[model samples]
Target: MQDVPRIIKAASLRHLTLGLAALLVLAITLALPAGPAAADPGDVEAASRGVVRVVIIGEEGDQPVPISHGTGFAVSPTRIVTNAHVVSEATQDDTLRIGIVPPEGKGGAFARVIAISPRNDLALLEIAKGALRLPPLALAGGNGANLGEVAAVGYPMNVDLAQGLDMADIFSAQPPVKSRGFLSGERPSRQFDTILHTAPIARGNSGGPLLDPCGRVIGVNSFSADSSGGDGEFYFAVSLRELLPFLRSNGVEPTTNTLPCRSIDELNAEERQRLEAEQSQARERMAQRSEEMREVRDKARLTAQMQVLAARENRMALALIALIAAIGAGYAASVWRGDAARTTQARLAAAASAAALVIAGLLWITRPGLAEIEDRVAAALAEAEGGPAPEPTSPSTAAEGDLICTLVPDRSRVTAARTDDVALEWSADGCVNGRTQYGLGKGGEWIRVFAAQEDSAVAVNTYDPATRTLRTDRYLLGAEALAEAREARAAYTPPSCGVSDAARTLGEQQSALIAKLPDRPNERLVYSCTAKAAAR
Candidate 1:
């Protein structure tokens, strides 16, 4: 019994603490001043995602070792741009291999030097687009890095030197070293378009991108003219005027964003300010409505008091007059009692006086009170819609943000299918003449996506390896829907068998629950795909 009381006391204390904490948080939230706030976007970090460390592998003393290396950035999903010299060593012989160290992972993917512009020291490298899909670096326009503005971006070199690292450390992982400086001037260049900037870089930084404040690549770092010994102070980069032409000629089209980049921090601050201002405005409106209600309520109360007081005074005055009349009638009745006609007249007068007194008494008792008027006023205010009700929060139909995907072939699940289902028509360059492939691993199961020969229909196959069960669902959609579904996610609720309603794709069972789609495959075709790359 004692322990029970102690436990109850402790629980009460905990609840009190929780209530206080919640109130404190609410107060803080309300105290924030209305100001500018916006969404924060990490553009610098996003740009760096496309930047990769290029390594040219060659023989050193008969053993294959890293020959030279530079930086390269993705202009498209499959294409990368770097300095011509970066892939020059690989061009000499088939033995030289070029590999890329992407920003995220430990290992790398191999790239083939696709195009070269020796005149401008720029080259484009092609990679297996299926292996990696990084956000392309947005290119700046003709009005590139401005004078006296800060230039900053990822670079290599000067790091190992500063760290006192030896040659063997070259193969080790190297993250991009960020450096910033002013754009001194554009050198008087006749060879090709160039930008002269004081952005700090090193020997291996030959092909690294020079970025503006919003993380847009304004120029490609090329060469440095030495005036003071060792490393130079004057560094020049290939400007967009020259670089854009090279990209166009090489069939490399990079995406560009025209809106000036805004710092994420500034955006977030702006958003917070806007939210606070909205809350403050709502509070002020409520306060104004309350003040108006108070004024109306006070006026009604005064009016009700005056009306009731007048009714009470009238009732009292009528009752006194009635009383005087009754007394006069009684005296007259006594005087007139001597004669029959006078007595009859006296009786009628007495009866009339009695009726008047009764009426006055009833009026006094039933008169409306001040409290009743106030109650009516309060009820009327309650019934009135004080102000416009706040809009209800909208319910989301689909998941927010983007359902970004890296489409690739289901290598593991392909083995489970019959050989006839998926003919191995993969070429050396990872393309098939008549088929397309895309799939994703989900819930420890493989979901294969297939496109028909005419590209008129698309199908999804979910396979259960453990049970060797294959479930195929097909849909015939317009080109836009098909293309959108491939790059993004499209899902529907799966049919349930004594289960909860959850969203899913094709499964073993198909019934009334599943939508009846049109123009599908004849028999689902036991869904499988040829793992061949498609050129986007």
Candidate 2:
């Protein structure tokens, strides 16, 4: 009985010991791995759009029941990628049906199994033409970097059970769950290439996309280990090495992105640096112009003063010479008073001297003043440039005519969009492509805002003519937000081109709506534009 107290103490400390070990493990996992930045909410939201639920339906006594459920993601507009086991029963039995529940909307869609690789445990299903359309997730060019951050997006069955959702609810569209963790390593499975990650996933999460911080598809979540052996749960995803060939063999072209993953904070910081550099350059330019103007003014003043002084000295000398000539002529006339021809010549000389004296007085009275120095400087500077100095104008006002705009990747953050150059036709009257009218925004930018009905995306496009920069920001909204945006769009009427006041009013209205949007956009594209030369 003496060891009873010691046994009790050990039992009590068991829970504490386990708890401390768990904490230590968590701290190590979080602190040790040098991974990409954490996932952004906007990026996750955008990536989740393509994630769907793959439900297997079986009919029992004329009643349809969901026999199995798993997750899948769009690889193309009409093709979905999922695990072979998810639809294996349906493939074996023709009567079994496969249903796809999108991330949004009212009802589910039916799809046909196009390709199934049992060895790789992968399958491709094609949705009916024009039945369902979802933005395909962009696959990462490589499997993934070790210890990098990753997110798994999918519809887990445990969640449905926890929410107590019925079969009908399962068919209805709903958003998927996102679990974030770090990539452990590349551990190829016995059957196929696989990437090992720590992103939590359940049975129903199979075939979902494992994404990077930038919302790029790094791998396809397929399965998880049965036991972690004291570590946290680890999951495995099908690597792109296997997925690429599988997709190509099926003739499905997947969108792949090779750009490095960057967080919004980094992008914002870079933008701030760029703006500061521009401001510094602008200040330098202003200082240089001020110096040039000072030099020009000083030079003009000196030249004008020298010219005036020379003119004055010449006038005084001419006046003195004329007086002396007049005195000589008077003396000649007196001496030659009796000679008529000499007297007439002397009289003519005196008249000419008197006229010269009047001209000198007028010249001295009409000499230029100090104010004329500024005028001379302006004229000199204008002459040097071959025209009057141009007044500074807003960039938006100067961006007109046909322009070829190339992507400024350093100044932009692109998640799922293309980097192709854009051709724009702009008019000085705020017309785009000669049809769509753009409103003048508060920042002196020409802006156009629109929300697509086909997708839950709102886009704001802005153009700064001064910088010749065009920017497009896309917001992937949820159901409620999309509804609100649609309502806002319905209430507003776009103004016609050339109506500055109306366009400004519309811009203000749109700006108010924009203010209500999330701080960061899902995708941002910036293009530097140049005018297209006229065809000869």
Judging by TM-score against the true structure, name the best candidate.
2
RMSD in Å for model 1: 23.8
Error of 1 at 149 (Å): 5.2
Alpha-carbon error at 82 in model 2, in Å? 0.7
Best by lDDT: 2
C-alpha local distance difference test of each model: 0.56, 0.78
Task: Please give the TM-score that candidate 1 achieves against the real structure.
Answer: 0.53
lDDT of 1 at 58: 62
Which digits, one per residue and each the tens of the lDDT, describe model 1 over residues 1-536? 23423322221101012244334433543464532222112334446667777777766677756656678887876688888876776787798888777766455678898888878888899886566554467786444534534444544556666898754466555557667665655544657887776677666676778876656688888766544433335567888888888999888777654443444344446648867998999899999988988887787667666776787678777767766776777677677777787878878776766776676577667766657777756655665556446576421211111121221222111101112333323222112222322122445444545543433345565543332334454443433444455433333333332232222323322221123334322123232332224311
> Once superposed on the true structure, which residue ranges of model 1 sit more than 4 Å away at CA?
1-46, 59-63, 89-95, 129-135, 140-144, 148-169, 186-188, 229-232, 244-255, 259-265, 268-298, 311-362, 376-536
lDDT of 2 at 440: 76
- Which residue pairs show collisions in model 2? 395-465, 395-466, 396-465
Poorest 10 consecutive residues by lDDT, candidate 2:
8-17
